[model samples]
Target: MSNILRIATFNVHKGLSTFNARFSLHDQRELLRKLHADIVFLQEVQDEHAKHSKRFSPFPLNGQLEFLADAVWPNYSYGKNSVYPAGHHGNAVLSKFPIINTENRDISAHSVEQRGMLHCEISIPGWDQTLHCICVHLGLFARWRTKQLQEVKRFIEDHVPADSPLIIAGDFNDWSLNAGRSFAESLHLREVFEHSHGKPAQSFPSWLPILRLDRIYTRGFSIRHVEVHTGPTWLKVSDHAVLTATLAHQTA
Candidate 1:
C-alpha cells in the first residue's frame, strides 16, 4: 500500500501570468500537473467568463479548476466565493484518492472581498482512517480575517474528527495579520513550510516575493520533508510560490 502522500498549496492568481500579459489555463494546468501532488489545494480558481480572459488572452474551454486539474487529477471540488462582472472565482481541491465527502463553506466577512474554504474527505489506500483536506482563502482586512478565522476554527471543530489525519492549506493573506496563528494554535496545527524552510516564503511578486501569504499545515501527519518549489518553472507559474510536503502518518 503506497500511503506515501504528497500535498501542495498554491494561489494560482486566477491562472493569469503574474499580472503579466500571458493568460493561458493550459500553462497553469501543465505547471500543476508536473508537481503531481497527491492532494492539491488551490486559491483563485476562475469558473467562467471568457470575455474577461480573452481581453488578456484566449484560455482553454474548461473552467480554471477543471483546466488546472486537467485529466491528470481524477477527483476535484470548487468552492466559489468572489463574483464579478468578469466571472466568479474561488478555491479548489484536487486529489488522487477516492473522495467520500465534500463541502464548501463561505467565510466572507465583508463586502469588499469574498473568500471561502473547500473541505474534502478522501479515503487513502493504506490508512485505516480517511484523510481530511481543506482549501482556504482569507480576506485582505486583518479584523475581518480574524472573524473568518474564528468561523474556520468552528467549522473544523464541528466537521472534522480530532483523531483523524488532517491537512489545512492555502492563502491566508497574512501580510500583517495573526489570524493564521489565532486559529492554528487552538487546533494545534503545525505549518509545513515554516517548520522546514522558515517564516519568509518569498511568494508575492513571484520574482521578488514580498509577502508570506501561502502555507501548508497538518496535525495528524508527521512531516518527513517540505519545500518551497522555487525552481525555474515555479518562478514563472504563479505569483505565490507553491509549498509541498511529504507526510508520514503518525502511527499510533
Candidate 2:
C-alpha cells in the first residue's frame, strides 16, 4: 500500500458567503472537516475581527483560523498580511502533523496590497524528511502577481531543501495563467489539477466557476486524485471552490 496524503486549498472569503451576505464560518468549518485533509491551505482567513465577533451569532472568540482548525487540526499557523481597524486577515495552514517551524514572509508588491506567504515545516510521523508547506495569497494586479510569484520561487529556493517534499497552495488570482508556466519552469512544481487533468481547475465564483483562481502545487509527491468542490452547498460557503488532492509519497 502507498503512503497517502490528502490536502486541500481554499480562499474562504473571510468565512462569508458571496457579497458578504451571510456569516458562514460555522458552515465553512463543517465543510472543511468533511474533507479530512491532512493539511489545509487557506487564504483570506480572518485572524481577528471585532465587528464580526459582535455581529455574528456564533463567531469564535479565539479567531477564524483557530475556530476552523478546532480539534481536527491541532497544529496550525497564521500569517496576517492585511490589517484594518476592525482587525486583520491573511493566510493560514492547518496540519494534522506537528509543525516544527513556521514563518510569514511579506510579499506585498506595494502599499495598497498587503500580501504574504506562510511557510511551515511539518514533522510527519516516522518520516525521515520534513514536509514544507506554503500558504499564499497573491496580489490581484498582473504585474504585482508576477513579482510576488518570483518572490515565492526565491523563498523556496533559499529556504526549502531541494530534495524535501513541498506543497504550495492558495489563491493566486492569476486568471491569465502565467503563474502555472512560471512555477513549472522555476520551481519544478506541478499544479495538482494540471498534472492530473491537463489544466488547473476552475474555482472562482463558486456557483458557476469560470476562473482558475485557486491552485495546489506539489513536488516530490505523485498525485492520485484531485477534486474541485462546487454546486449549491459549496457555493453557500465562499466565492472560490475548495480544491482537494490525494497524493502518494515518493520514496526514493
Candidate 3:
C-alpha cells in the first residue's frame, strides 16, 4: 500500500461570498470535488438554515455536509456548534475510508461564541492503526482560544493513542500565531505548511490572503507537500482559502 494521504481543510464561511452577496455552495462543492482529498476537514458548515433552505432552490434537504460529500465521500460526520432559531453551523469531516467512530465535543469558552470539535476514527483497510481526524474551529478571542486549545489537548490525551496517525485541522482563527508553540509541544504534531516551507501559509481573506488563520497539523506523518489555494476560483468559494497537504505515514 502507498501509505500516502491527501488531506484538506477549509472554512467555507457558511458557503457565502465575501460579504454575503451571494450563495455559492454549488460552486464550492465542485471545487471540493477537484481536490480529490482522501479526507476533508471543514469549518463553518451549515447543518441547517431555515431561511437558506427556502431561499436557495437547490439547497440539499439533508445538510450542507451531505450536499458537499455527495457520492464521493461515503462517510461523513458533523458537529453542530452554534445554533439559532434560523439554523446552525459547525465543523464537519468527510472521509473516503470507513468511519468506525465519531464524536462531537463542545469546548466553548463561553455561551456567546459556541464551538466544538468533530473527531472521527477512520478504518483504512491496510493500515495497522486507525486514522484519527479532528475537525476544529476555535474561538476568535485570544483568551477563549487559549482555553479551547487546552480542551483539545485533553481530548487527545484521553482518546487518541499517542502513536496513531492523527490529523488536527480547521480554522484556528489564531492570526497572531499565539497557539502554535503550545500545540506543537503538547501534540507532537507539525503544521503541514510550516513543516514544508518553514512558515505557515497565509489563508484568510482568500482574494489577497495575508493572515494565517487556518491550519492542518499532523502526527506520525511526513509532510510530502503543502499549499494554500488563493486563485480566483478559491476566492469565489469562500473568504478563507483552502489549505491542503499530502502526508506519508511514518513507519514504526
Candidate 4:
C-alpha cells in the first residue's frame, strides 16, 4: 500500500483580514477545514490576545491553534514567538496523526522580531519511523531571514535522524527567492512548487499575489501535486495564499 499525504502551509495573519479590517478567525477556521490537509503548518497564529478577545465578537476563548484545530486535527503543537502586553502569537502544526514529541526553538535575530521554529515528531499509523515536521515563520529583513535559515538547518542536523521523512513549511518571507537554493544545497530538500512548476508559487498579498513568500519543502517523498489557494474568499481570510502539496512516501 502506498502512503500519500496531503499537507498545507499558511500564514493566517493572526486571524485578521487585511489592514485589520475585520476579525476573520471564524472564516479562517472554515477555510482550513475545506483544505482537508493531513498536516497543516501555520504561522502568525495568535495563542492569546487580551484586547482582541474583548473586541472581536466570536474570538476564541482558548486560542487560535485550538480553535483552528478543533475536532478536525486532533493533534497540535504551538511555538510562541512574539509576546507583548496585548498577548502572544507564533507558529503551529496541526496533524491527523499522533504527535509524540514537540519542541520550540527561538531563532530571533533581534529583539524586535521574535521568531521561532516549531518541531514535531508525528507517529503515522503503520509507519515504522516517525515523521519530522517543522513549522517556521522567518523575519522580515533579508539578513535576519538568512541567519534564521542557518539556525533551522543546524536544528535539523542536530536533532532529526538522517534517514527520517522530514518536512519544513511556513512563511519564509523570502522575496529574493534565495532560500530554495540554500535548502536544496544544504539539506537536499525540494520545494514542492519549485519542483513541479520550476519556481516557487507567488503567495503574498493574497488578493493579487505577486511575491513568493510562503513555501513547503520536503525530503523522502515524491511530489505528486501542488497548489496555491488564492481567491476572493481566501483573500478575506489572510494576506498570504495557502500552499498545499500531495506527496507519496518513498519507502526504503
Whole-model lDDT, model 4: 0.91
For candidate 2, the 10 contiguous residues with the lowest summed lDDT are 179-188
lDDT of 1 by residue, 117-210 (tens): 8899999887888899989998888888898888888988998889988998889888763677667789998887666765635566666667
Off by over 4 Å in 2: none
**lDDT (CA) per prediction:** 0.80, 0.91, 0.90, 0.91
Compose the digit string of candidate 2's lDDT tens values, residues 101-155: 9999999999999999999999997677899999999989999999999899989
* Model 3: residues with Cα > 4 Å off, grouped in runs: none
lDDT of 3: 0.90
**After TM-score superposition, what is the CA distance of residue 4 in candidate 2 from its true location, in Å?**
1.0
Q: Write the per-residue lDDT of candidate 4 for residues 55-143, one digit (tens) a residue.
A: 99888889889999999999999999999999999999999999999999999999989999999999998777889999999999989
What is the TM-score (0 to 1) of candidate 1?
Answer: 0.92
Per-model TM against the reference: 0.92, 0.98, 0.97, 0.98
Give the per-residue lDDT of model 3 (tens digit) for 77-113: 9999999999999999999999999999999999889
lDDT of 4 at 9: 95
Clashing residue pairs in all predictions, respectively, total 0, 0, 0, 0
Residue pairs in clash, model 3: none
| Deviating ranges (above 4 Å) for candidate 1 | 56-58, 198-200, 231-236
How well does candidate 1 score on lDDT at residue 197?
A: 65
